[model samples]
Target: MDFKVQLLQRKSKIDKVIGEVFKDKNGLQKTVIEAMEYSIKAGGKRLRPVLLLEVCNILDGDIDYAMPFALAMEMIHTYSLIHDDLPAMDNDDYRRGKLTNHKVYGEGIAILAGDGLLNLAFETMLDSINNDPKLCNRGIKAMQIISKASGINGMIGGQVVDLEWEGKKIDIETLDFIHKHKTSALIEASINAGAILGGAEENQYLELQNYGRCIGLAFQIVDDILDEIGDEEKLGKKVGSDKSNEKSTYPSLYGIEKSKEIVSGLIENSLKSLEIFKEKAEFLRSLAKYLEVRDH
Candidate 1:
């Protein structure tokens, strides 16, 4: 199948899972659930969950068992976006060509919605484990990877640096730290957790982890490039916020041409890391290539 076709299929599956997550909305907190549904249903690439499932598929793991983890990964990612777009954070007005969470649901509800997603992500993972205690060990391990990645030393830590360094002259090391922690951490977790649940060998696990790190960094670099020169209509969000916010980015540090070169290098490394998987990794290889040229 074509890469985009495969991508759309996976996205559709992910969307289905998300849709079912809040279908039975009958409680006092229904509004919060609705808000949560609003953000998660807002269309995007669903890259994190797609990566998680693909990793499992390539390793011949049980997709049914991995489904909860994939959903959890997406929930955490969406929660971050909801908070990221708040008045106190990125202060954005749009996402995925629609109003941001706060814009439609009000800031208070949006805040609760983000919090609800974060908590429900854990519940979803734990529920899976509860339903199948035999897989408890694997489930716990995957959850641990995700927890650390989204925790204080990972995504949140990176966000702190990103917020603090806005409008400040930051060095390459600081910029790298922010990217690795804030963005790359969760991406790495998606792959690492999938590898664990997929029963990968130590070598395969390490290689996939490295691949995740490379592509994750490259993904952010592409975002940086797009922020500078991308079409806002295609992006579904305002462009040039990086400059307006004075955020430190690969493009800001190295110029657009140089940043593109860097993204190419990272994508190259990511593909190389999957060489051991050979033909089975063809989809992943194509994905890395796609990231290099994706407009949004």
Candidate 2:
């Protein structure tokens, strides 16, 4: 199958699993649950989880066995977006072309909804262990990678730096740190987790880690470009707010043309890192190109 077809099929499968997980279960915490459902189910590419599953599938790993972890990755990504859109953060009112969770459910419930998703992400990771006892060790390793990525040293650390440096003319090192932590950390984790769950050997796993790092950085740089020149309708979220928030972006640090150069270079490096995979990594190579050029 072509990469696009395979990508579309995998995305649909991830969406189905996510939908099932958030479906009504007769729980009493209806408000938060609704908020969770709204945020996670909001239409988008569902990129992170698909990336996880793709790495697994490319390694000849069972997609079904990797499904739970893939779903957990998406849940965590959604939770991060929900929190990032809060008034205290980016303060966006819309996401994926719909009202943000806080906008519809109030700030309090939105906060809880993010918290719920984050916590439930861990539970879901554990569920993969229960699904197959032999996978228990891999699940634990995946969880640790994900936890570190989402924690103070990774995403949160980047976020803190972002907050502190907002409106300031930051140096290149600071800017790189912010991007690597804020965006790239979770992306890298998704790739690593897939490798682990897919039973990758040490060298393949290390190569994927390098591949993830390059793409993660490239992905955020594209996001920076999108914020500058992307169509609002296509982007499914407001743009120009990066400037409004006084945030430093790739385009801000380096002009738009230079930012594009940087992205192209990173994608090149990413593809090079995967050369060891030879023909087995074509999907990943194509995906990196897609991320570099993606509008959203």
Candidate 3:
């Protein structure tokens, strides 16, 4: 199958799983459910979950067992986005071509919605584990990987650095720290979690970690590039917010051409790390290439 078709197939599966969440919810707490549903259902690439599943597939892992983890990872990702777009953060009004959570649901509800999603993500994972005692060890390990990635040592820590350095003359080291923690951490966790669930060897796990890191950094670099020059319509969000907010980005520090070069290098490194998987990694190779040229 073509790469796009394969990607859409995985995305469709994920969407179906996510769509079933809170569907029958009602009563006084329904508003918060609506707020949570609104953000998660808003369309985007679903890259994190897709990565988890694809890695599981490559390692011949049980997709049924992995499904809950995929959903949980996406929930965590969506919650982060909801919080990231708050008035105190980036203060954005649009995401995935729709009104942001805070814009329609109000900030207080939006915050609760984000928190709700975060808690529910762990709930989903734990539910899956409790229902299948056989999967306890691997499931727990996968959950730990995701938890640390989104915790203070990972995404939140990176966010703090990014927020603190806004408009400051930051050096390359600081910029690298922000990118590695804020963006690359979760991406790495997704791949690593999948590898663990799939029973990968130590070497395979390490190589996939390298691949994840390269592509994760490249993903953010492309994001920075698009924010500078991409079409708002295609991106489904306002462009140039990074500039207005004075966020330190790859393009801001290295210039567009240089940033493109850096992305190319990262993509190359990612591909090289996948060489051991050979034909099995075709989808991931194509994904890395797509990241280099995508507008959104």
Expressed as tens digits, the lDDT of each residue in 1-296 for candidate 2 is: 88779779878887888888867857688878888999998987877898898888778887787888888888888888898889998788988899999999999999999999999998887877887887788888888998999999999899889878878888899999999999999899999999988899999999899999999999999999999899998998778878877778889888999999989998998998899888988889989998987877
Best by TM-score: 1
How well does each candidate superpose onto the true structure, as a TM-score?
Answer: 0.98, 0.96, 0.97
Score candidate 2 by TM-score against the native. 0.96
Candidate 3, residues 12-103, lDDT tens digits: the string is 99999999987877688999999999999999799999999989989999888888998988898899999999999878888888999999
Worst 10 residues of 2 by lDDT: 22-31
| CA RMSD of each candidate after superposition | 0.9, 1.4, 1.1
**Comparing 1 and 2 on TM-score, the stronger one:** 1
Clashing residue pairs for model 2: none
Whose lDDT is higher: candidate 1's or candidate 3's?
1
Rank order by TM-score, top first?
A: 1, 3, 2
Any residue pairs clashing in model 1, and if so which?
Answer: none
If both were scored by lDDT, which would come out higher, candidate 2 or candidate 3?
A: 3
